[model samples]
Target: MSNEHTTITESLAKVATRANELCNTVDAQIDNIKNTLKAEQDALQAKKTQFDAQAASSISQYQGKMDDFIESGDNRYQKALSKGDVIVPVNLKHLDDSKFYPVTLYHCKMLDVRVERYVHDDVSGGGILDYFVQLQNWSNGGDFTFAKQFHHSYSGRAFVGKISAASTPYTSSIWLRGGWSYKFYLNGHYSKGPVVIESETQVVERIASTDYFLAPITEVQPHVAANNFILGV
Candidate 1:
């Protein structure tokens, strides 16, 4: 009976040792799995951060291009004028002739102007002024001749010329009026750019010594109001 009891006690001890070994193995496996999962999580987090950085950089570059397009008044994407391409006219009514009656009128207003040191397809050459002018009632009677005077505060001289054209929309880069030919690159000291352009217009009327002239002086002068465009660039 004592031998049987010893054998039973030894067997119980072996079983307990085996159970402890199994428990230790399970704990090691669990710890290894946890470590592997943590490593994978860290790697995924790093990849996400890299992707976010790349996306942010791309967004910033795209925004910069958009800003340039807005400032340049050109649309490279659509190859045409964008939504904000056209400049708003300072004075729209200066190109109209409803203010004057019974006599033909001549009018000119600057629609758009831009200045740059370097010439591009969209930009004129350096020291050059590209402008669009609007005319009204110029061809009502016949070929009419009118003088165009360009004045600027920076330029000491006024560019004056006689232009003859039928009534139509006018756009020209021929005459560098307003002394812009001399003052093109002179604005290097300015914070903006070497060239600064203001889109403004002035109009003058030519009076013939005839019945129409006397009619306005005697009769229409009282009823007619002079539609004047204050030079505001």
Candidate 2:
């Protein structure tokens, strides 16, 4: 009886050991499947990030190119007065009035004029100099009005502005787009009056981003010295 009982106990131990071995093998397989899925997910995420970065770069590059194209087109289409050439529009009635409730030129295009000046003179036998940037709106089978609505500009002018109001003599020359700000004066003397309405670096009003472009002007002193700065037209 003792021998039989011992034999039965040994058989049961073997069965339990075999079951444990099978369970461990199954667990290992499950771990392998989990690791494989995780690696695949990580690879997909990396590819997505790379693709998104490339797409963003492409968009930025194209946007810059488009802007350049617009600027170049505007330069050619707008009829501006060349150096040493005195020009005026022939059709006076079609011209828009300068100053007070300024209107946008036809076709949603604005006449951009920039102006800056520095001059000095004594209160005796005096001399004064003025500078200006003049532009004309060429007929596109319609509007023939010139853009003269700026500082020290007249009825036939479309775009103009005063550049500086500093008390110093300055040489007259083309003041390009740099170190300048547009000040819309609301009131009195000495550069800008007592009240300055608004100051801006650029006046960018357009039909979307690809239409009109603006530019600046000018002049002399009372024992005069001044630099009135503006960008307009």
Candidate 3:
């Protein structure tokens, strides 16, 4: 009986040891699985954070572009409402006597004139005496009405004259709503018969009353010590 009891006790001890070893193996496997899962979770979370930051930056850039486009459109609209359409100058010398000068004016309230007179160096006897430029509007076929006139005198080598409606009443500001065609006629003569002369006329469209104020101030000082600054006509 004692031998049977010892054998049974030994067998029970072996069973307990086997059970402990199985439990330890299972615990180690569970720990390894947990670590793997945790590492995968951390990697996924990092990728998610990077994607979120990139998305936010892209959204911000797109919003800024949209705002700039809107502002640019608004600025263009305001400028169109405030400013007048520019009228390009036409050279009268190029046009023939049969053809009348044609110009389109949109919201034109004032007219700006620039006349340049250049005399040849070889010109000795004759010089520019009385020079006048007239603006005539003939929207009604043959009948024409004078709009503005600029009278200037040139004597020396080269002369440049600028005349505005504000300074001279003869070249006063005129309002034209609808598009109208205007003609420029230059009536001038020289002292000693026909002399080589070059002349140009420019008409600028003004939208506001203070448009003339924006012109650049040109200082014209006479060479003579006693004479003051000569104001060009």
Candidate 4:
């Protein structure tokens, strides 16, 4: 009887040991599955990062190409066709008296405008344009406006509010730089209003980059007047 009891006890102990080993094996399998899932997740995250970087680089390249295409000469010429052209008179310094008519136009703001004249290289044998000056109107920045008129020296008559489309619109790289071979970059003002200007074959005198009359011109500009005499704002 004692021997039989001992055998039963031993058998029970062996069964418990087997159960413990199976539990350990199951735990190890679970751990391996967890590790495999984590590795797969990390791989997926790396792929996403790579995809995002590649998309950004592709977008940047497209943007650069679009900018270049917009700035191309052909693009500008098309835009100019819509904005029109500015025709500069062949004889700017000396105009016929008929061009200057009495004008009593008034405005609160007149901005300064600058222009420089140079020779036009007309490959054609027509020397008539050899001395023609191209008027470049660079649109000015800031709202600082002044008073004065685009005057004709010969007639001593000042005029305003006349941007004729007869030739084209006055333009430059400053306000615009697309259209025609005429390119002028200047900082100055014209009266505030809807006035277009185009000067081709235009001319203006210059005392180098410095001019003596600039002070006097500015002083006269502030001399606000309705009759072109002496008045104040």
Whole-structure CA lDDT of model 1: 0.34
lDDT of 2: 0.35
Over the stretch 1-233, how does candidate 1's per-residue lDDT look in tens digits?
Answer: 99999999999999999999999999999999999999999999999999999999999999998898788653453222122343221211222222211111223222112222113222243222222222222333344433232222211221212122222222122122332222121101111111112232222222453221201111223211122212444
Rank by lDDT, highest first.
3, 2, 1, 4
Candidate order (TM-score): 1, 3, 4, 2
lDDT of candidate 3 vs native? 0.37
TM-score winner among the candidates?
Answer: 1
Per-residue lDDT over 120-215 for candidate 4, one digit per residue giving the tens place of the 0 to 100 score: 322232111111111223222223322233321211122221221111122211111111122222222333222222333222112347321100
Candidate 2 stretches with Cα past 4 Å from truth are: 74-233
After superposing candidate 4 on the true structure, give the runs of residues whose Cα lies further than 4 Å from its correct spot.
73-233
Question: Would you estimate the TM-scores of all the predictions?
Answer: 0.33, 0.30, 0.31, 0.31
RMSD of each: 16.4, 19.1, 17.6, 16.7
Question: Could you tell which candidate, 2 or 4, scores higher by lDDT?
Answer: 2
* Predicted candidate 3 versus true structure: per-residue lDDT over 1-233, tens digit per residue: 99999999999999999999999999999999999999999999999999999999999999988998787887754343233342222333433322222222222132223232234322443233222333332222133333343444455421222222222211222221111122222222111111111211333323346222112122322321111222443
Report every candidate's CA lDDT.
0.34, 0.35, 0.37, 0.33
Candidate with more favorable, higher TM-score: 1 or 2: 1
